[model samples]
Every structure is written in C-alpha cells, then in structure tokens.
Target: MTNLRIRAVEAGDLIPVDLPAPRPDVDGARWRRTRVAVADGQIVGIASVALSAATDSYFCEVEVVPGHRRRGIGTQLYAAVHRLTDPRFPVLARAMDSFPLRRRFAEALGCSVVTRCPAPWIDPPTPAAESWATGQQAPAGYRTTVIGDRPLAIVKDAWASSFAWVHRAFGAVHIDRIPQMWDQYSKGVDPAASAVAVDRNQTIVAFSLVSPDAWDGRTFIVAETAHPDQAHGTQVLGATVATSVTVLARRGTRRVQLEGHTTDRHTPDVMRSLPAVGSDPMDILRLEPPPAVSRGGCR
Candidate 1:
C-alpha cells in the first residue's frame, strides 16, 4: 500500500486491465474521466465515470487486475470514480453476475438491481434448424435490407425508441449521443449480417444489429428491435433476426448470443422462439442515494 498511487489518465493512456476500452471516438467521451491505481509503476486497477446525455445518468466501470484482488485497490479505484460522479443524477454500474466479487462490491455501495438480462448463446443454425427461419418474411409492405443502407441517425432514433424502456431508470437516450453509443456497441460488426426492415416509405421500422463478440471471434452478438408503434413489430423483428442470423452462420460464426432482459417484452419472446443452448445472466445495478440525516440544535 505504501507505493500505491492513483492518478487521472486520458482514454489513450488506459492500460487494458482486461476492461473494455472506453474509446475516445464517442462524441461525449471527452466528458468521461478515468483513474488508475499504479503500484511500482504498473497499473493494477482502473475506474472511469462518465455522464451520458443519452441515458441521463452517470455510468461507472471499475476493474482490478487478478493478482491485485482482496487488497483495497478496487475500493480506492471506485472511490475515485464516485468522487467524480455528479450527484444530481443517479449512478449506474454494470457488473457481470459471473463475477460475484464485482457484484458484491456494487451491492456494498447500496446499489440495487434495476434490470436483469440473460444473454443466451445459440449454436449457428444447421440445415435442419435453418429451414424454420430461412423462409421467414418481413411484414406486409415491408422489405428487408442491410442496416448500412440507412443513415445512422435514422437507425439511432429507431433503436432508442424501441429499447428505451429497458433503461427507464436512466431515462431516454438523447439523439446527440447516438454516434458514440453506436461506435461503442457496434465494434467489429458484420455489415452484411445486420439487417433492417423498411416500410414502403423507406423508413426503418425494425432492425437486427449483429457484431462479433469482442472476447470471442467465433461468437456473435445479435440484437433485434422494432418500433412499438408498428402494428406488426413482432413479425418485423422475427424476420430481421432470421435474416441476420442466417448470414452470420453462413459467414462461419459458430455461436450467436441473443440479449434479452426481463423488462423487454419483445426480445424475450424473440429469444424464446430461437434454438438456444444456454445463457449467461447479468444485472445492472443502480446506486441509491444515502438517507438524509437530521441535525440537532440547542434550543
């Protein structure tokens, strides 16, 4: 503990520490502040806190290197991030359930689960499995196309509108933050494997966002969404997922992950309709404000 030092760093200066790089390309990434715990000139723990206009909350991420756990390093890193968080808005931390230590740390801070989701890994459709979705079609008057055919702005709006309910604790996503959010979520995405459903007016009403999992090249993440106003959203979503997953399997992706939260009505149904192997569940924890204290005065 004597040689431990915690200092601020720019996005470029971040040492991986096995955490996702909050790349600076996001438009609002400049507002994100990072801190690292260094001992003997080597980074062993990292923490970052950023205000997202899209979610209207302070988002935080913290990680300590394997050999450095059980020390107060994680607590110190988290303290740095909490100090940087704006108290006006709630703070949300995403800790994978697979890591009980991380989750326990968040719980110790009075954080409670806001949402629970199980991301399932499904085997790429074989010839027999392919037949079911292979013939699926978009809703009447809607045509299927690659997501790249549409402008990102349009896609962003459609995506936020459909998925905003899952993040209700944080509020709706602002239009300006879309680019940064997309850059973060769509890394290594397969353009051909991502599909969209456009109505006759050339408006995108539904989409399937497909990207290779960052940790596993053979595994892909598949996210599907459709506008709630669309009377046939279910059909559109099914068709889009069918189209995207087929192309992903054809491209040699071995496993596809379908993310579904208990709060989402559409995605859970869509995921259940598919042939999935197993799931990895996780929870999003939101820090609750401490109870106000009363002051006593001499009368």
Candidate 2:
C-alpha cells in the first residue's frame, strides 16, 4: 500500500461505491458516517457504524476491496470507526457464506457468531388490493389496521415493550425497542408500510413494521411482534403481510421482504404463510475492540 490513509467521509463519498445504507436503527442523529481507507486517491475499503444512545450495542459494516486485502487496510478502517463510535458498544455484521475472508477478519477482531443462522428472507409478489387476504379470524376483541391510523405514542410504546416478552427463551437484539432508535427507523419509510392489531381496549397486541431496504428502495420488515395468545401470533403476522403488500402495491411497491432467525419460534409459520424467492445464508458476528484499542473508543 502506498500512501495509505484512512479518513472520515460524508454519506456522498460512499454512494459511488455502493455500500449499504447505515441501519435505520438509531437514536438522536443518523450514523451513516463513513471512514474510508484510500491509497493514492483510490478507495480501498469503507468502515461504518450505527449509533443510538438507547441501545446496548452497535451494528457495523466494513468493506475492503478484494484486491486490497492482505495489506492491513481493513484493520485500520475498523480502528478508525471505533474512534467515532464508543468502543464499549458491541458491533455486529453479517458474514456471507461466500466470504470466508470477511469471517476470518471479523473473528480476528474478537467477533463471534450470535445469530441462530443466516437470517431468512421473504419477498412476496405484490398482489392487487382485492387479491391480498389472510383468512384467519382475528382473536376476540382484536382488530388489525395500518399502524399509522393509531396514535404514534401507542404504537411506539407497543414497539418498545414487545422486546421483553416475544421470544422469552431465545435472546436477541431488539434495536427498535428503544424509542429514539425507533425514531430514526420510522423516519426512513412510510408508516402505512406497518400494520398493527389492537385489542378491545385499544392496546396494541400484535404488530409488524417495514422500512425501505437499505441496499435498495424495496420494502423490508424492520420489526414485528405478536401477542402469544393468537395462534402463535401467525394470524396477526399474516394480516400484517397482507396489509403491507396490498397497501404498498397500490402505491407502486412491487415487492416486500422479511427476515427471520433460524431458532425463532415464528420462522416456520412465516415461511408457510408467504412465498420466498431465496435466502442469503448469513452468520451474524459480534465484535468488540481489543483492550488496548478499546481504551480510547475509536482512535
């Protein structure tokens, strides 16, 4: 590497190279900030982090041009990012099955696999409003509607509270449970893209939320939760998918996506209810800086 330099950059700098947008999960301000490793004015790799005061950990993405590997660019880029994000926040990223080098690098940096499996994805073809339907009967006193039709705070509260009870035995990160982070997420996509089921008392009992897929403008399910009382919550989920697809399609949305963890109890029901085009086999890796590097955050 000649004259290799790692420096902070704006969102625009990353656009040309096609890095995925920072996770919509954040608090206070957006954290799509990028630090790039460049050699002789050519970008070699980019390292970025998701920041939110409300969450216990962070999510990060790093990309080093395949040809630029074995030269230490990624290590420097990662170190640069930790300086900006509090090193105390644990960071996670997906390691694709085809990219063993990325897995090795992430592992070398103290990351370990956390997801039960590569997340599952579903992209149902957008159907006409008249064609979309979920036949299950709504639980007594429960009614489903577009999330925006309800009060924002009620929806937000339900969104925040669901994190604790949904999958009791299986531990996982719930980024949207934090209101401020949810603030960042909700701002990025239409609230109509979300659906919620409310009980007779008007308390939200089940819900599903979607946002624009960061890599593309298509819809992606950012969060979902269902009350345990109703058919393992599938009816609500089914209604949610049906509502989202019909509404979004009316607005010209051609497709919708949802991701599931392998161990999640709802995975099977979700798969059976909707059609899936394919899945990206992925491993979620958790990362923390080394003691020496952690002392100063992201130096």
Candidate 3:
C-alpha cells in the first residue's frame, strides 16, 4: 500500500487534483479535464477530453503514475473519462501498436479499431540550400511565396479549394478531419513556417503547412498538399520543404515530421528526400452511441 491515495471526487472532497491548463487551440466549450492525486500530492492519473481535428471528435488521454504497474488506477481513470463523452461526434484515441495494453484498455472502454495512421519523420540539418533553394526549378511558370509574403486573405481563398483536393487524395477514414477550410488549418499556426507555391498569375498550385509540434518550437510537422502526380509532387514537396526549412532554421529547430494517414497518397521522390521515416501506426478506436442516446444525440 505504498502511500497510494485515490477516491471519488465530489463538491467538497478537499482533494486537489491538478487539472490540465486550458489550451487555446482546443475548443473551449468542449474541452474537459480531470485529475486524481496520490500520496505526497503527486499526480497518479489524469483524464482529458480534448479536440482532435483529424477525428472530428474529442480525443482522450489518461495518464498514470510512472513505474506503477499491475494496478487498476488506469481502468478507474478511464471509467471517469468515458462519462465525459458527448456521443455526438466520435470519441476516439490513437492506441500505439507498440503497447498492446493500450489497445486492450481502449477496447474495455468500448472503443473499436478503425484505421492505422503513419507518422513519418525527418532528421535535422535538412538538404543543403542549393538543392532546394527558394523556388528551385518550380514548374516552368510557377514561383514560390511564403505565408507572410502574400496577404493572408488572398492566400486563404486561394487554398480553400485545395483542401478538398487533399482530402480526396488521402481519403482518410475520419473524413471529417482533413481541414475543410483554411481557418481550421490556420489556428495555432505560424504564418512564417508554412510554404506556398504559386503561378505567375497569382494562383496557388501547391502548398505545405509546417508548424511547431508544441510550444517548445524545437520540432515541426509538415503537411504537404499538391496535385496527384509524380512531377507535381516532386516539385511541390521540394519547394515547400525548402521554404519551410528556412523558417525552421531561423527558429533553431532541426527536426521535422510529415504525418499522414496510412491511406494518403505517397510519392517516392518526396519520401526519398528525407530518408529517416518512422511510421508510428496509430490504431484509431471508435464507439457508436447507445440506441437511446443515438436517437436524441442529433440536434
């Protein structure tokens, strides 16, 4: 019983659960948090229901005391998290394939496997300047411009239609995610970190959105978008990374990842550019609402 402490929370429990701080990126009204403390006032577990644009639903996370195993704290914490689900949008989680128990526990919570996602990675000190210079050999008529080099409003409108194209190309199972609009893609985004390739007529042909993976700004994720073809893919990928590399180097960041669903289209020319590819297959789990709840769930 090594100083373990846990109890049901109530209005006057006097237990100081360290709730997660509010994040502006998450939808404020839908965001939720819970914490259960242990002996010495340390966190034994925490359950959070946050926004996941990819799932078009709330994503869940349950943290437990490190190095404490063979205990039921995780089960208890997830039970509490299950109670917070809205049942309208799909409540989902990305269970790591490396951890079999994570998938088992999620199943216990009524989640079922949906699909796997690939999390590709790239090392620091990207390709030299000359190989991927600004506008390096863009499609004959195409040139390069960054997010901030052009007006924000025009850029948004130009790329608005491209979002649908990207979604179609990927055909993600969570079709609701795919950034249907520029506004959804721009939140918590650094304008300077993203890249856009445009034609002489002032039209966006291909683009890439790269932003710090977290507040630390040391690592970035690049979401590439372009027409479905080899030549266009190579051109867009090179130019986009080139533009974003400059932005990242300025911030002293040397690592970047290109994350996408397993079903998304892949171009060898683009993939070969960054040899270090780490595919973390995320097993998405989803649960349908109960019959009664499903009947009344719709607004």
Clashes of each: 1, 4, 0
Best by lDDT: 1
Regarding lDDT, does 2 or 3 come out ahead? 2
Worst 10 residues of 2 by lDDT: 290-299
140-225 in candidate 2: lDDT tens per residue?
66677876655545577666655544433334545544666557666765676677777687767666676766444446764455
Please list all clashing residue pairs in model 2, or write none if there are none.
26-181, 82-298, 83-298, 83-299
CA shift of 156, model 1, Å? 4.0
Global CA lDDT computed for model 3? 0.55
lDDT of 3 by residue, 1-299 (tens): 46656543434434223444322323443355554535555556655666554434666776665555447676556556556666666666778665677676666556566656544455444555323444345667777667875554555543444444544442333434443435655665667777777767766656666667742233555445444542465675567666776677566565466545444354335545555535444676664333322232111
Tell me the deviation in Å of residue 1 in model 3: 10
Q: Each candidate: what lDDT?
A: 0.67, 0.60, 0.55
For candidate 3, give the lDDT of residue 265.
Answer: 54
Q: Which candidate wins on TM-score?
A: 1
lDDT of predicted model 1: 0.67
Across residues 255-275, which tens digit of lDDT does each residue of candidate 1 receive? 677765666556777776776
